[model samples]
Target: MTPPSAPPPPADGLLAAGRRNLRALAHAVSHPSHPPTPLFADAPKRWQRLLPYVVVVALVATFLPLTITVLTDYGMSGGLAGAIAAVQTVPLLMIAHRPLQAWWIILPADVVGGLFALGGPASQSSWPWTPSVIVAYLFLMLALALRETRQTLIGVWLVTGAAGAVLGRLFPGESDGTNVLLLVLSAVVLVIGGALRERGEAQRRLVEQETISEAERAHRTLLEERTRIARELHDVVAHHMSVITVQADSAPYRVGGLPPEAQAEFASIAASARESLTEMRRLLSVLRSEDATGERAPQPGLDRLQQLVEATVRAGVPAGLSLTAGLAEPGRLPQTIDLSAYRIVQEALANVVRHAPGADTRVSVSSDGTDLTVLVVNGPPAGPASPVEAGGAGGHGLVGMRERVRLTGGTLDTGPLPDGGFRVAARLPLGTKEPVSP
Candidate 1:
């Protein structure tokens, strides 16, 4: 068995805390290896570029007279007083580069300047803190507050107060509350500068987050559109495969074929078509989201265009539809082409209603035997755009339309009209296997 150790003394904890604080202060002030922090890094305008130089000029102008006054009042030689004034003022330029280092230089220069100015014939009210030194230190504190950590700033403030106290004790005279005044002014400047820097950082973070969110949303929308296109195309392809399977299975019996090899070949064709349909359905299941119940209704075709246009007209956008007489004949166009054409027109009209409320719109569909042309155009809005529209409600209008047309090897054209309206036109080849006319 080991002997138990005695409890540590209470002073041990206090000593540890003091050592920790001192270490923290040392770490806060000593590391000045970071790149320079520009005061106007993002200034884009001409006046903004010139503003920093203007501030330097103004500070120089103000410090000039104060330096002359300090020289006369302190009764120091010209070169000595001017050198001290230069130490106080010139380090301000370094604040943009190494603020903590600048503070280290300025604080000591301030102490020495105060020591010489004490009890001078010209020194009346102000004691250790001359008007010029107060102003210069305040500026330095403001820069430090913006760039440095709060611990560093607290260290700087504590050191400033300690310096003023030491100078007061060394030369006891009518100190005139200059020490308190300088500390209070520097504290206020530090607080305001810290607040402004925090606000700017928060704004930058917010903008960056918004940009990332926008990119993610666009990517999500693209994936959803592709899934929808695959689902619809699956349905179209499945229908054609089902027809091929039935025709191949029935050909031997219905056509009165005599050869056994021919019947076996027909059977093979039917089996292959059925297998393909089964795989497509499996692939479709993977494409569909879990929440989708699977639409069992027959997909709409070009025949539904009139009803779509009528619905849009009832919704407030005065609209008209035109369909060529031949398009009415059933089986005139394949199911894939028919579905693609209908979806393009449906999305286009929906966009008009949402984006250009109360605008005149026209939708026309015609087939020239080799190609099918669809056109939907809407005029400018008769009323002000709703907040939702102006803010871009994030509809997948153009994305869906372009995808549908592309599946059928079609061409799509969409843009804003010169009359402040919108146009969406698509030309689809009549036969998928045939080359499209230029």
Candidate 2:
């Protein structure tokens, strides 16, 4: 059988340290090691809206070089003609960078540039700029579709198409059916891709939120279970120890006026019982949750066998406790070993108080390399007064101690001693121990 595992340390220190470090890192990141303010925060939306206008200006700029070439051939001064053409390209550059607000500036610039191209002394027709316009429009729409949702891309496409149709009507161009169909198909692809991206992002976020919620619920359930177990342990120890305390305190007074040696023995028993009560109280104090501010102390471990023996003594039982090795070096003993050892001793002493009052008891604890051994023996009840209430009442103390020992992969033997008393002995393996049956 496997030995019982050790209990976990209290969570307060580790959890607090983790939270402190996380908070510090969050504060440091928010402030940054070196801070810089970002620019153009509001520029993207404006740029999206002005994209079509920017495309129109770019198309106009593309036709300028050819127009200027013909104008110079017809006797226009080369330097003067080049200056006029250069002016038309300005709006295109500005609109490309600041699309939304560029319309107010570019619309007037477009009319002047258009007049110059159409009415110059060396003017020539370069009317159909459809291919350049279509390419620029497609590029802008593709960018918007990749960055935004379907609805926004659709709005942009509709606006650009309507404006383009109006310009085409005013300045007639040759267009084949296939070119128009390709343009429409490209626009449809942009809208579909944008819609899918938005849908996928939404679904991913929903799944993440659900996962977080489930984890939080599991954490709360674990906390509740821990609290419930703590409460049960507290209740069990308090009830049984309280009974032992009453019986121990009343024993000396009940058997009055005995021989000096007998009286001294009874007094020693009372003192031992008081000490046990004190240690039990100390153990209970440690078990109290940290939320309480009272001065209650922490519980005892296997290190306090003397105190246990003293308590047994106060209960009118003569207890001789011998320890070959103190708990100073638990070595590889698991937490279960420590807890079970403490509990087994506590239960054994309580049994002496209840079922073997005024009897001589011997408590011994020794470790042989890998196994811990505990033996508690008591001579029969001192008087005919039946030390225990009899029946099943005297059985449970031994059963409980055995069960605790077994959980640590130990063996327990409890039965009548040849000398007319009872003895309980347990051997708990330091490694790979299994639970003992009651």
Candidate 3:
């Protein structure tokens, strides 16, 4: 059997730990890329008037004992002693703006003090890996990690490691200062710093993405509302324009002979109105073509309710309409309310034609001064539904009715009735409006 291996050196544990940390850092960035000195991880807050000053005082305090030891034991001049103190504290002061660069400043300052300014490397860990320099680097790394990106963090870790490795070899200390173990410990700290930086970046990106998604969703909703308004405009305006064209064309015949110029002007108005109506219908078809059959038809309103009911009746459903609350009166309804009422009626009737075919359907409209109420009811179906039922709008008819009532600041109720029929009703509030003649 092979002889038992010698126990590993003490520094080997530090090396292993550092490598494990470096691996963890790599994994963190491979996937993606808090609080305080309470955690040894917070950057000083610059907004507080005394935070920077406090940091300077605290860093100076830490180095004070070391500074005196360097002065008395090394016999360094007073000016040189002050210079070493400055190297340790100034970087800590400047850490917020230029943390990585501050780290660079502290590292070489420690080297210079170790080699030339202070006494010989006689007492402890020599030149590069001295205690003072280690403290400076730790503080600086903690600050820099909060600000730097993953790539910059890797560069920082490498630079610090390489510098320590080279110096350790050149001026080896009593405690193996020039050894790879110093580089390992440095790697561990810097890797942890880099991991922290990446996490911060990832969280910032998540918040930004959420904000963008919210804005995009709002924009999309606005565009959809605009499109629906345009469709309603087409349906309502085209009907009025067609009526205007007919009235203009028939005015001379209905009233009496007119002057030649007046007749020509009326003809011009009729032609223009007909052209506009044609274009509106075309646009509506393009925007809302419901079937591949490609049938293009005029939009219907209350004026066309009789024709619509006749068609529904012919399609095997008996349908009728009742009107009250001055809604039955012609020519005084607000155009917006008229259009909404028509569309609501159309959608409810369509639902009946599809879902409850062969069922008797009744649509009733009643209004108090402030609100118009619409109700559509259908008897239970007599038999299996036709293909129209299978291919008809899925749940979208109710959705459209709800939106229409919502636009009017209204309430809608729809459900099965106790009598084995379905009921759809809406109470739409009418705001004050200047009435338009029919």
Candidate 4:
């Protein structure tokens, strides 16, 4: 027969890849060399966005007067003036699309454009270009600050200074030396501002990363604690409940020869208490740990099917077992699979004793190469009344059985049989066993 199929891998791989790509893109855009914070943090919401646009507009506005003067005095037409102005406008507008890492492109483009404008028809007066160039330098500084790039900030300063020097030569201004000095000073301010912005961005990124790490650590700790609790409850409560059930079943038989009324009453009380304790323990164990203990011996497997049958017989429930095929051949099966199978049988028998007492029960366990199958069927209760005691309708037994089968990638079905009893059938993959610590 074919080996059992493994469970499908988790579906989050694609989602994880997508998140990684997005993070890389954001880092390239906002941090470049440094780590990045959230996008909204790097691209501040309010006046920060408008500040870049404002600087660009102010620089262009300052240049308009110089262009107008040169055109008027040199007989330069409006078309030529508009064309020069449009060149600067187009590149600044493009900044909205490209990431700040591409700011180097804008620096050279702005400087060259400014020098060309100064040496052309707009050369009558240098006053307008001075403020315009300085304003452009300031805007470049702001962009560099936001981008946290030291080299770009320095480049912006050098380009602005060079443009001012060329303009002084072309226009022969009265205060040429002073104008150059002011432009040099402006560059210094831009560099300092850019440095500060970079520091802030770095700190923001560090804080965000720490927060994320802490939250993840806490979540993992909580999960581990829950798993430990589940394992503890399973060992403590399940063990005691098993012992109590054994004791309760033997109570009436041991007290034989007593008055019928006293015997029946004592049996009823014992049964009632056993059922109550089972329900209480089941509820309490809900919070138990999930971790399997390695020190504890692994649970019994299919080999213990006979022992499970005997336990049911001692509990006053007649159970017959049959195996048509797929025995593990000694050590072929893993411990986890064995334990799960044993538990499935144990639970099925327990249900038969509690819900179908005195009913004839048949258990069939077989393997079909890759899969192990178990079928438990019971006849109707032998007495006139239902075997299910009052207030014993907590459905945790079936739920627990299903949980066991699910962990092994198995299937289970249980319902009332058409013949007036109940039947539970399970199919577990033999190969897709989970890890058992022991």
Best by TM-score: 1
Better of 1 and 4 by TM-score: 1
Kindly indicate the candidate among 2 and 3 with the higher TM-score.
Answer: 3
Question: Using alpha carbons, what is the TM-score of model 4?
Answer: 0.38
Error of 3 at 41 (Å): 16
lDDT (10s digit) by residue, model 2, range 13-95: 88998798666544432332211222123346877566555655666567557545644543557885566445534434443
Separately for all candidates shown, the number of backbone clashes (residues 3 or more apart, or on different chains) is 0, 22, 2, 9
Which candidate comes out best when scored by lDDT? Answer: 1
- Candidates' lDDT values, in order? 0.83, 0.58, 0.68, 0.61
Q: Which 10 residues in a row give candidate 1 its minimum summed lDDT?
A: 429-438
The alpha-carbon deviation from the true structure for residue 96 of candidate 1, after best TM-score superposition, in angstroms, is 4.3
Error of 3 at 103 (Å): 2.6
TM-score of each: 0.87, 0.34, 0.56, 0.38
Distance from true position, residue 406, model 4, in Å?
15
In model 4, which regions exceed 4 Å deviation? 1-78, 95-129, 159-175, 238-438
Candidate rank order under TM-score: 1, 3, 4, 2
Q: Candidate 1: where is the Cα deviation over 4 Å?
A: 1-14, 32-34, 96-98, 173-175, 258-261, 367-371, 429-438
| Candidate 4 per-residue C-alpha lDDT over 1-438 given as tens digits, one digit per residue, 9 for 90 to 100 | 999999776779878887886665445434444333322333647676565556556655665565444433444457765565455444544333332544545445545444544433444444424444455445544555555456544444555566556656766743236456556666677667767776887898999999998788666655554454355445544555666666656766776676778767766766776787767656655544445223375345677788789888887788899975547455656544566677777777877777677889999988877887888998997754353453454334565666667666788899997878998898888775662331
